[model samples]
Target: MTGAPRIALITGATQGLGLALAEGLAQRLAPDDTVYLTGRDLDRVNHAVESLPGGGARVRGELLDVADPHAAGRLAGRLAARHGGVDVVFGNAVMRVGPDDDPREIVTEYAEVNNFGTTRLLRAFAPLLRDGGRLVVVASSLGTLHYLAPILHDRFDGATSLDEVDAQVAAWRDAVADGSARGGPWPGFVNIPSKIGQVAAVRAFARERRGHDLAHGVLVAAVCPGMMNTPTSAEWWDVRGAPGPAEAAVPLLDLALGPVDPLHYGRLVRNGKVLPWSPYRDDSA
Candidate 1:
């Protein structure tokens, strides 16, 4: 891996969109560039690496459970020591809880894996990024600030700090615990809040990167694939006729492989376009 042209780390690459992105990257990989693919299961991770486009010879697999922050830090440390650093870090792993589950359990699971776990990876891997690096977060269209409850919209819109974001997340967890989240606008929507928190995290990362000299030239942004047909949403995709993982990977590939545009920094992108956050753009119905 020494003297590689470029290095990239992609999590949750065992299946679905993560696998698609890995394949896409592999198809266009420069001879010296290397892409690290990670997943919870070692067998699955190795299989994914082998199955990637162009034989995936350049892809390396690692075991990673995003929910384990300590392990994530260790992985980051290893990457730092091995390659000296990386140029891109993609946060693609996610977990969701349905409305039928206990409210507290649903909120807790989603917050832990999606929100807190993602935060941990971002924080741990950020210092390992070389100058002019990029961080691409796989977010969802439904996670936009526009889809948040009115009160939450106000709070998140005004959140200028990670502490504020954590406070708001804590409040939401409390509401779920006490049953107040049941009839609320985003009631039982496990992925919504988690995704929203991811978007907010992108903003926070971009803001904080500017203050740290080690993190200079690093750009943070999130992307939504526009309702792709994957294992998790087979029924919805069956009826909606949405594109499959291979096709949906195009826009995300553009974000993952292209040069960073200053205007798009810290923004949410969909269909290869930057999506503005406005209540008027709310189409969650």
Candidate 2:
């Protein structure tokens, strides 16, 4: 509404927070604007597109599996060809690992989808951002630096490039395979490191982009939409009375379509406020 006809993309948008994000964007965008809702399942993607408010005129669904190393790149190519550039991108696809899940499988899956998936999106789509575009990576509160041991803080915070972040993730994956990750500074919960790597990738990408010569400059933020009563949440914990995805999507919609602030750039944000790297108390609650 505030800008020209925009093009937006939301990955893993067939259900939960991703679907809510797609709906919000579709409602707020101009009638001529296009909102792409991507998921791995074609039927689910079609269902999500049909479920939107406007009879699927401007909303288009595409199959996307972020875990596939080449999928994001291919999607980016198609979108770039069609729209020239994108106005907004929400890296919302994620994977959750349960306690009963195999540690080795968790390591491989989380590394592919959660950690490097963020990297893949950044690499593929960041360059295609139109002037005054926005890129929001939907991370988690567990991604805060304080969630891990103090000794591990520098690895994320000191990362000034995406390659550095990738190196850290690779190192962690190797440690997990070699059985040395148990007593290391890493958190016992595998999801924490994966989310941290996501936030780190966004930060590193933003920092690297600062030196580039793009007009109006793109805005990038890693967002923690907080806990919600989604299917994904139900897989890991009890969400008896938690807010639904639509309610949780309010702030994310604001971050995506609302005004941008330079101060919030490259920072982990929640409810329109910047989340501290290390707070005195648990800020997640």
Candidate 3:
């Protein structure tokens, strides 16, 4: 926005990988360019903004809850008013309803944050994105089932609003709604269906938004930030432990702000490899 060549907004930029990303980006960006760091906690956001290493890129803080229905549009308007428009919008912030939360609750959480929070921002900000601009979604490897088995596409790909996600969940509401997403899970696998659904949503967004093709004309890619050390997954893996968010931010950074092509939209990519999450890997072992 503001006729600038580059301006970025990273949500959930306070702690964990998000903070690391803000730090990393600050090191590389110029002083003129700004990176708006947002988070639910105002203190954390302020800290993130103030903590930006004195350098080329400037830092700003905003308190936001991605799960809020009105937050996305408000942010979009803020960007429009403050900076004319935006060139880069990274939809990285997400909050899960947790393992203990019922399926309905989880669906609600996902719809609130991931589906609505991120998707709505993407849609509202679509106007601000420069013609050749980049949009990076810091999804998880959990968003893909290729590494596990038996992938499935969401029947809800056409949904673009909360009403739609609710309707879709209602459809499953009547069914036996197995969180496993299939008859059962493969050994060492958890939440397979939800992950697959995420990938499907990314693909669906691309298909519906970009001529019903794959990875076309836009630099859209959903990266599986493999098992990062974050609280989101603590419900199941706490005992086993996991890599810290700082550690997992490497690949994520690449997916978000690194150099890439514009036609790779809707590509469920990892590192440089295209993961196989379709055709439903039947190996249940």
lDDT-wise, the better of 1 and 2 is 2
C-alpha positional error of residue 190 in candidate 1 after TM-score superposition, expressed in Å: 2.0
Runs of candidate 3 exceeding 4 Å displacement: 1-5, 96-107, 145-193, 209-217, 231-235, 238-243, 280-285
Model 1: per-residue Cα lDDT over 1-285, one tens digit each: 224567888888888888888877777667667789998899999888877666432788999888785878999988888888887788888874443566676677667677777777778887887776777888888767767767668666667766777677767877887788787765466677778888887776667665552236666778888887665686334635788888988888777667666656777888767777656553221
Give lDDT: candidate 2, residue 108: 76
Residue 4 C-alpha lDDT in model 3: 60
Candidate 2 per-residue C-alpha lDDT over 89-186 given as tens digits, one digit per residue, 9 for 90 to 100: 99998876776887666687778888888899999998888887888999988888878888888888789988899999999987886778977887
> What lDDT does model 1 reach?
0.75
User: Who is ahead in lDDT, 2 or 3?
Assistant: 2
Worst lDDT run of 10 residues, candidate 3, spans 181-190
TM-score sort, best first:
2, 1, 3
Q: Between prediction 1 and prediction 3, which has the larger lDDT?
A: 1
TM-score of every candidate: 0.87, 0.92, 0.75
